[model samples]
Target chain A: MEGRLARIGLRIWVGGVLLFLFVPIAIICFYAFNSSNIQSWPIQGLSVKWFSVAWHDPQVRAAFVLSLKAGVFATAIALLLGSAAAFGVHRFRFFGREAVSLLLVLPLALPGIITGIALNSAFSFAGIGLSLLTIVIGHATFCIVVVYNNVIARLRRVSGSVYEASADLGAHGFFTFRTVTLPMLSTALISGALLAFALSFDEVIVTTFTAGAQNTLPLWIFGAIRLGQQLPEVNVVVVAVLLLTVIPVIIAVRLTGGGGITRGSAAARSAMDSGSPGA
Target chain B: MTSTVAQGGRPGGEPASSRHAGGVPGGGSARLAAALWRRAWLRATLTLTPPLAWFLVIYLASLVVMLVTAFWSVNPFTNTLVHTWTLSNFRQLFTSTYLIIIGRTVGMAALVTVTDAVLAFPFAYYMARLASNRGRQLLFTAVLLPLWASYIARVYAWIVILQKGGTLSWSFQKLGLGAVNIGYTNTAMWLVFSYIWLPFMIVPVYAALERIPDSLLEASGDLGAHNWRTLRSVLLPLALPGVVAGSIFTFSLTLGDFITPLLVGGANSNFIGNVIYSNLGTAGNLPFAAALAVVPIVIMVFYLLGARLLGAFESL
Candidate 1:
């Protein structure tokens, strides 16, 4: 009975933790329909009027479009460059390979403030104006690691014999890659891209340093809160971004399960598995 | 024809298909591909060049430039960077005020890390050992889904909850516990920081706990160890790396985060990140900002090294 009671106590604790996690999200969603402009304990009433108000706001629309543009551009660049690095590191032994891996992971491992200030100062020194392009560049640096981890993890699982068989069957490298490798790596690539896009969309710190005379959604929300204006509209935009990011994350969770690509030594072990047939 | 194909022959005497194999327009790409395939070094170079150049040129070079800039002073009249190097920024940072700021930020981070560890351990342990596979999956989603919520939105929810006459106060009054307002204070910052980083703590600890072999626990039991002793000796030691790993996230994230503090913290809640941001953003004092940022960078370098020593990197 003591053991059973202990188990029950643990269950209640976990449930409370889950509630703590979601209560704020629930509040965000609830206030999206809040009729009152002011945020108070008891939401005055429920209404969908803020959704249309948020939609019609020109600043919100522009910020939304800008975020989408940056997210897409960054994810595209990350996919191309990240997968190539993953493939190179996976298939061949090279000098500074460990250094390359460390460099790739450094952006995520280090605090965003460091990355923000570093990029911001660099842009100023180089006389490059902060703009959409700068934002994309800053975001793509970290997004590369997301794609690299996913592709490298999937690459480790792919048997090297497949590549050899294609070569033996008189197919050239390009043809073999298109027919054999691309298909095998598609899911990992898609999930990586989704994750990269989601991350870029919600990013604020680096975006703050890298943008000039423009606002992404998060930056706009930051300004709105600081200026303390259009408070309910902030709720509407938050709810929309929340949904947009949550869907892709749910899909990615389904694709990779609990073992996210960047989890740890499991992914690193695959990356270091140089004795595979393909290698 | 078969005999002629098999026979050694001059170029003009070769089979038509064999001749076309090396000469067709399609074969041009094929030839290039074959050549690349033959040279592993060239292939590696081709694939590594783009990403390598990006990290080196954009990320690392920028970091070096930023660090170097910290040694230089600003031209007060024009707000331009002076090429001459000086230690004034560092000298200023060593003052008691800046030292206190650094100490406060570090202390807050430590508190948040400990709070998250205490909160996350039980949930992670239950999920790892007690829950069914389906329940674990659902629980995993439950934990991860909140990450998708806009961080600002979540922080704002705390503001709404912690504000005067907000949900907490209202509920307390209903329960005859009386009203309590903790809004816009360091206490609020701690709660929000703990909330924001809890998921990061949970995932690593969960991964660590799940990896503990059931046999070890059984071995302890067979030796007549009670539950508490087994937990202290076998479970805690094994999970230490995971706890350490989770702490790295909780600690460093709090150390560098200004957003949670900005939204939830009162007048005096400035972290190292906030100081750096204002110095650069409003004061236009790049050198000073860079100098302040160096504190966290140094702290984190040591933190990361310590974590690696604890075998946290494997669990990361």
Candidate 2:
């Protein structure tokens, strides 16, 4: 019953929204090549001079390396802990199971500042110093939920009969687990690890409190932005980060067989559904 | 078939019932596996302990410690936490300065939530119902990509566009509107907050709308209802849980954010997060910061309860 004019109007509106969403990102990328230090509209000359500056900057290199280390460590921890928790909740019915699910989600559901300050207080109380270990702990706390959600959703979809058949075939539990369960969970784990790494890589809020004097990539960018002097360097670093982030996400989408990020699982839906509380 | 069956039985070398009774004749690791396989509690405990211990000890304990610290006051002279329980930190939150900060934060969060819901609905509708299969996939990726992009970079992009002598001013000047600088203003913060969180609103709404079958819309059209009537009666109600689910993100993200205010806010734009952050860091007032942090936590607990009541969890 819709009219032609209305349909066309809707299409135009959608196109406009897309533009609104993307133009700022385009502006950031475009400004990175600006030859002049000043960031006014319209181009002066375009140059790649900032690339060398950002490359040579000791602070930026340290931050990038630190971010990489934290992301790798955090993703490793989340994969182990998250899958364990997922199998716990999925394979067996136990008391407090719902509470466990809710608890697993709490780090993600609550605002990041809450998580940040809470961990900060606890660290100081326990006489623990803020370091790379602390940053990984903060990131892994949230990353666990992402991995948990993916694994549990996949676990739910896998048929219980397959395990039973393996058992009946005189294949012991460990052997069946190594062959059957691991293969079934391979994609889910890969996608989960990729996403977890991405999240830990770009994370800023919880990292801010937990990093102490250390700078992750986002923290370095924040300092630079606040200083307002290193516009070009910030732009270069940001472009690199965009690439760093987009690759994993693209890989994750492909690995999940192209349901896109939000459609991966019900738990993922709830996780994203909860939104990034700190962002 | 007979040979294959005999070969399989030969490996076991005993009746299955006898194997069950004696726990499968095997080496230590295999025996341990057999024992674990039989015991449900052991399996649950083995799988559950590490993650649960991590959460309970690290995550949950930290929250409890923060909450307890909120009651204890910090000694100003020594810059040490006084273990004596007191409500003075919480009492300070009721002061006029703190109250305004709380009001502004909640108000802005509400405004952003409304703005995002309005902006997202039409776009999500187009994606869900109108786009072709390939088009829908592209739109989904477009929405998902920015989420993974650095949050700081996105906010920084806005700074470049909003600052004096920036892209926005250049555009305005070119249009004969004279130079316009809205940079470092609350207005800038509002725009950035709404912009960043818009995808959070769209994805869930699109998911909810996609779940609605096409036959229902056709049925509504056949019942003598017009386009607006079908949208209002058939579509809006069905899509509302999604909207509420999205609002939870938009609202809580705004409520807890300090970065936007720090980057783009003017002199008067001290959000609760900003205040708490400063207190915990520069001010060295941990107790006060913990007390202030409680406000958003309480707000979200209620907000989440409201969302749960609206069936937003189901949509998610």
lDDT of residue B156 for candidate 2: 87
**Distance from true position, residue A189, model 1, in Å?**
1.1
lDDT, candidate 2, A221-261, per-residue tens: 98888888787899899888877877887887667643324
Question: Which segments of model 1 are wrong by more than 4 Å?
Answer: A258-279, B1-26
TM-scores for the candidates: 0.91, 0.92
Candidate with the greatest lDDT versus the true structure? 2
Q: For candidate 2, give the lDDT of residue B184.
A: 88
- Residue A58 lDDT (model 2): 97
Clashes of each: 0, 0
**Highest TM-score against the true fold, candidate:** 2
Q: Residue A31 error for model 2, in Å?
A: 1.8
Which DockQ-derived CAPRI band holds candidate 2?
A: acceptable
- Docking outcome class, model 1: acceptable
